[model samples]
Target: MTSHKRWGLFFFLAPVVLWLFVMIVLPHIDLLVMSFRFENDEGQMQWSLNNYLAFFEEPIYWLTFVRTAIYSILVTFLTFVIALPLAFYITKVVNPKYQGFLLVLLLLPFWVSELVRVYGWMILLRESGVINHFLLKAGILRQPIEMLYRDSTMILGLVYTSMLFMVVPIVSVLDSLDNSLIEAAYDLGANMWTILFKIIIPHASPGIMSGSIVVFMLTLGNYLTPNLMGGKNSLWFTEQIYNQFIASFNWNQGSAFGFLLLVLSSIVVWLGLKLTRQNLKKVVQ
Candidate 1:
């Protein structure tokens, strides 16, 4: 390239390069440094694998990691299930004029902080909350059902929190689907379910993968939802990181845990790309 072209490219890329260094590279370097340090009785740092050793030796830490993985998987699947159907309906069946409004309504929760949303769920799920109150008033239960602070509620919160990410991609992809494809399927006597599974889904694979990856990664790093809804008894990996860094003052273990999560998310992104195996330009068009 010419000198002018090279300078132009550098000018355009400078901000992103600086951002990556400042936000990502710097912290990761710090984590690497901290992960090698060992704290003495005087609260000073030395060098050792004691932090990593403690992490591996504890079964609870491993269990927390597995629990986080399972929760992320479940939330990803649930988000896909809910978002796919809704996206299809909005793109195919809903009026074009109302689609924008409906989508905004679906994503309105973004206006509120996640902490507030979790607390809202808490109110709805609590024994004395609206859900139990309505059930009791209707005589559906003799007593209030225990709805709060469970795996199910945690999963629900995860799904709700990540729903918009799933919906937007699917909607964008489905909106671009050619109507003639479905018409051709129908003229050939393909049933609704057959058309959906065999034709529509294959065409939307890229969007599905994108949405799934986003939801899964977000859920994997999620701390507040699991903490608030799953409560203290629930084993979450991020909580373990928090305990190590804050309570135990073991920055090395926390860094190790964060690195583990980063690896898991990378694997998920790789698998998603492999499964989709479509060019970005084609999907965007």
Candidate 2:
């Protein structure tokens, strides 16, 4: 309302505005332009949708794109499932004095780079790694088991990397919930299942939704974990994009794939919100 407040707000928002434009807007605009055109033999750029059409026409692209989207969603749901109980135990069951300690434990893994964590898993699961060595020493197995490079392994890596993101949000929302509500529900002859489904889940839905959105996007865009943990057999959409950009040097097709991925991921998030009967604004808040 006043010039002083306006100036203050402007100063506060300036960095974010600049970053969004410079980092997101400009790059995307260029990508969108590149997506629609490519230089032909005559050395002229012509607009076309064949880049997008190729995604459907080619089996590899079609399958990989769908697989990546499905896997990302599945990973998001799995993370939520694991996070719910973990968050509940941390926020509702743990003593307030030890809450920070538990959170610190959760955060400890994240302090190092994600690449490091994946490699840690790789080491633990490799044929001659710690787990196999332990198993062999204890006579639990006849021979070393190869544990790295599989869909389940890749999914495990994704879930491990994403757990904190989901748990933190859920814990944030759950901490605000009053224990008295659960007590009252019990007094009114409500069971644990009823109380959880009727009260706790509804109260925590916004946080769950917010966390899901972040995890989904992160998992969808993630390159390293899937590539390394899932091996060369993992046909992730990002790998396809990387091949187009780096391997084949086809920026136009890469841009098209990138744009399509953005659009589809957005749609999936929108549909999720609609199905859950949650508002994006409320979730964000």
Candidate 3:
């Protein structure tokens, strides 16, 4: 390559390389080092496996970790369930002119900050909030129901927040699908279910996998949604990490929790890829 081209390439790549090193690599290295050290009863910092061991030894910590994993999976599944049909409808049934408008509506909520969105849910679901007030006025219920700070409410918040992430990918894949394939399948005596399962799903697998991975990761790492919506009963692993770092001021334990979350999320993504028989390269594409 000519020197000018090489210089152009270097200029283009330099910012990304610097960003990866500065923002991601350095922080992870610092956290990894911190995870192995702890202040003892004597107030002296020492390197040990105690931070990790404590995770295994403490039932609450391990249980919360497992619970967070399960909840994240559930949220991803729920988001997929909600998004798939909506995506299909938007891409397949809706008029082409109106599709963009519908997608804009889906994205409108996200224009606001996530903290604001979660607070919006709090307002709608709280006993004295809109829903309850409406229901009481209509005599649907004599008393206001306790809605906030529940597991279902927390899951609902997660599903709502992550919906667009799941929908956009499915819509992209579905939009590219040729209508002739469905026509051919029908001509070959394939029913709706067969066409959906044998043709549509297979074509959409990459998008589904991509969307699932993104939504799952986001849901798993989310702190504000669970903490604010589920309150003290959330039992989310991220909450534990927050408590360690901010509340208790235990940086070592927080770093360990953070690493553990990273590991758990990796394993879950790996398992998802294996189960779906998806190529990571294709899914990411």
- Which candidate number maximizes TM-score? 3
Cα lDDT for residue 96, candidate 3? 91
Order by lDDT, highest first: 3, 2, 1
Candidate with better lDDT, 2 vs 3: 3
Cα lDDT listed for each candidate: 0.88, 0.94, 0.96
Candidate 3 lDDT over residue span 111-228, tens digit each: 9999999999999999899999999999999999989999999999999999999999999999999989999999999999999999998999999999999999999999999999
lDDT of 2 by residue, 194-229 (tens): 999998999999999999999999999999999988
Which order, best to worst by TM-score?
Answer: 3, 2, 1
- By lDDT, the best candidate is 3
Q: Of 1 and 2, which scores higher on TM-score? A: 2
- Candidate 1 lDDT over 1-285, as tens digits, reads 699999999999999999999999999999988887888899888988777777679888888788788779888999999999999999999989999999999989999999999999999999899999999999998899878888888899999999999999999999889999999999999999999998899988888887887788899988999999999866889899998889988678899888878887887677667666865455444
* Lowest-sum lDDT 10-residue window in model 2: 38-47
TM-score for every candidate vs. truth? 0.92, 0.96, 0.97
Off by over 4 Å in 1: 1-4, 40-47, 275-285
